[model samples]
Target: MAAPRAVIVHRTSELTELLARHGTRGQVSFFLEQRGQSLAAVEERHDRTRAALADVTAGLPVDWRRASVERGELARSVFEPDDVILVVGQDGLVANAAKYLGAQPVIGIDPLPGVNAGILVPHAPAEGGALAEAARTGAAPLCERTMVRVRTDDGQSLTALNEVMIGQPGHQSARYTLDVDGRSERQSSSGVIVGTGTGATGWCSSIARVQSPRLALPAPTDRGLAWFVREPWPSPSTGADLLAGLLHGDAVQLRVESDQLVAFGDGMEDDRLTLSWGQRVRIEVADRTLRTVRSVR
Candidate 1:
């Protein structure tokens, strides 16, 4: 048997990013002042995040092996099945790390606590140690959150904990042949989005609300997904018949009719799949679920 490891996944704080962006802390402070935002707030958050991460690291069992990685480095980090993932930050960070993971249990620790909607990150920094032990022993309660996957014809696939967006990079009109449940049609629109129940509150909800206000989207732990086509354009060659619907036991398929198209997950544009003309992409509910560890304290 392999030794259980604790993996702390985090991201550079806003202050840190600002410093890198402006080349100095002094410049970052001036930049925030111009926007009527005080640098103190950002500094406080940065400190909180660092302290929380330190606490999580210190709380791990003395005998357990540990490793840490920033959110941007997740794609490059190799994870083991026995690793307990500790995500220290807002809920979005947990979602960001989800696509790079498999079945490992994730413990979301909110450093700022009530500042952000703590859906994915339900635990606080204080419970880090208990959460670690619970997850390691498989005694922690888990919410098996569903996810979405987009696969290209050439065997490339990407999973998103929130939703998968397929269209042009800046969301220009995307031309494609929409296929669902064996029916197909040529359509032109902003693009397509397939989201899991976990994505409901994010980009999926913002669009779903306007497209289908009466539609009931799946809950966090639900099995189904809500999908929608953005601002479908109707022309002589294209029809906007299929606007939106709930997906369960079925997947949305698209064939690129334009010169080029791209598929990205969870708002990650840089990391995406490029599809040329005559290519096909399939959007479906992913088989892998994000197992989030609940608070054991």
Candidate 2:
């Protein structure tokens, strides 16, 4: 039998993007210099990323097939069940890749180790080969991270590794009917955020910091979701009592009362579900979880 393929995922470097926009490296350097900056740091970071990619590519086992995809192309990229995923970018790229993956094990490699506070990227580039080997051999230590899901009544659905945002497109107040447990409330607010335990330290934490002080956020592996209604306004017709809470059992359902509302996951605004007036959206813990490879050492 052939060894399972390794799908390496990455994003374009800032330097590369600058060069593409300016048409040349010299133009990029000149553009930066005009702004009192030099291209040395950008060039250094780019070089580090290139070196990391080289190290990871060189580390793959001889028998394993390898494939590469950019972060922007993940939506259209296909993965086999046995394929191992290697994400070479910051923590957000792991989240970006997680939604498209099924049960595959993912190894997050930070190209620049010390420079990034990688919450999801736990492996350094030097460990890339070892991680790839372990993943192929089924010997990698795994961490199961919970994810959030949003399903609309019209059969549209989205899953998020970090958090899901339901709101109007332009930061306008969103009106909706929120139903949880056995109770329901009509609310007019800025938006709604549904987050998983793996996202507790992110947007959910920020919402918890100011809105619900008594809410204890879940751990990364916890099978629960935290939700917050941003800037809920209390009116005679709308209530603010159900501003924030934890969702566990049956999904928390929301009915849109605005002209249009959007549901986006993991901060990918371009990829979203459109919810028109009177449309219902159910937010819950995703049936699938992210399997992240952790360092054995």
Candidate 3:
């Protein structure tokens, strides 16, 4: 039987060299690129990648391919189940590649070493271990980190890796009704965030100071939701009741007079949801979860 194919992804100059060194030791490697970005930036990254590759594969009998998945057919051809895709730099490419191929085992590489690779895989726990089952058996669990389902007021459902933020697109403050689990509260702020563990470090982190609770499940504990209230009116003070209610999956309702309000997930702009004053914005815990590959040490 042939050894499983391991595709090594790289970006920065130094890391590419590291991958080349690792690849010569029996690992199958490939180079992946994105569609749109500054050419100067791309050339710079590419040059760095080549230099790294040269250093690592100095005397090895190796062949590397610059596979561009620009076209639809090309993308389909690059992503296959038998391939174990490894992303070396950022998670953007890996995330995009997963959309094309659902069965491939995608892993993130930690360039700095000791740093958390944060490699999210499409695996779930079962018999044996999640990692073993994923590597040898190719058994895909029902739940994956990419399994996010969000329902909007427009009767549309969406998914994202990061937190969903609610904000108004104008200078005027967005007055919204926040409903957590079952209770409701009025809010007038720049925006509100409904985030998951995966997105806690992003927008959620930016808005407030969130510490990873040492507990088994590190749910975000907010002292109180912050509202960016314009001068003249006092800032909306999120009380303990609101904080407790939000943590427990209470649905929040937000109402605004203007239709300039917007709902964003993972920092992307979602369609304008039709809502009225005192319209309830439901914020609750989701059943779906993200599966991440962690380091042994």
TM agreement with the true structure for every prediction: 0.96, 0.95, 0.51
- Alpha-carbon lDDT, every model: 0.89, 0.90, 0.42
Among these predictions, the greatest TM-score belongs to: 1
**What RMSD does each model have against the real structure?**
1.4, 1.5, 11.0
Q: By lDDT, who's the top model here?
A: 2
Using TM-score as the measure, name the better of candidate 2 and candidate 3: 2
Runs off by more than 4 Å, candidate 2:
34-36
The true-versus-predicted C-alpha distance at residue 171 of model 2, in Å, is: 2.0
Candidate 2 lDDT over 1-297, as tens digits, reads 776798999999999899889999889989999999889999999999999999998888778899999989999999999998999998989999888999999999999988876888878877887887787788988999999999999898899999999999998999999998788999999999989888897778888999998999988899998888899999999999987888777678899999999999988989899999999999999999999997665
**TM-score computed on alpha carbons, candidate 3:** 0.51
Which has the better TM-score: candidate 1, or candidate 2? 1
Ranking by lDDT: 2, 1, 3
Q: For model 2, what is the C-alpha lDDT against the true structure?
A: 0.90
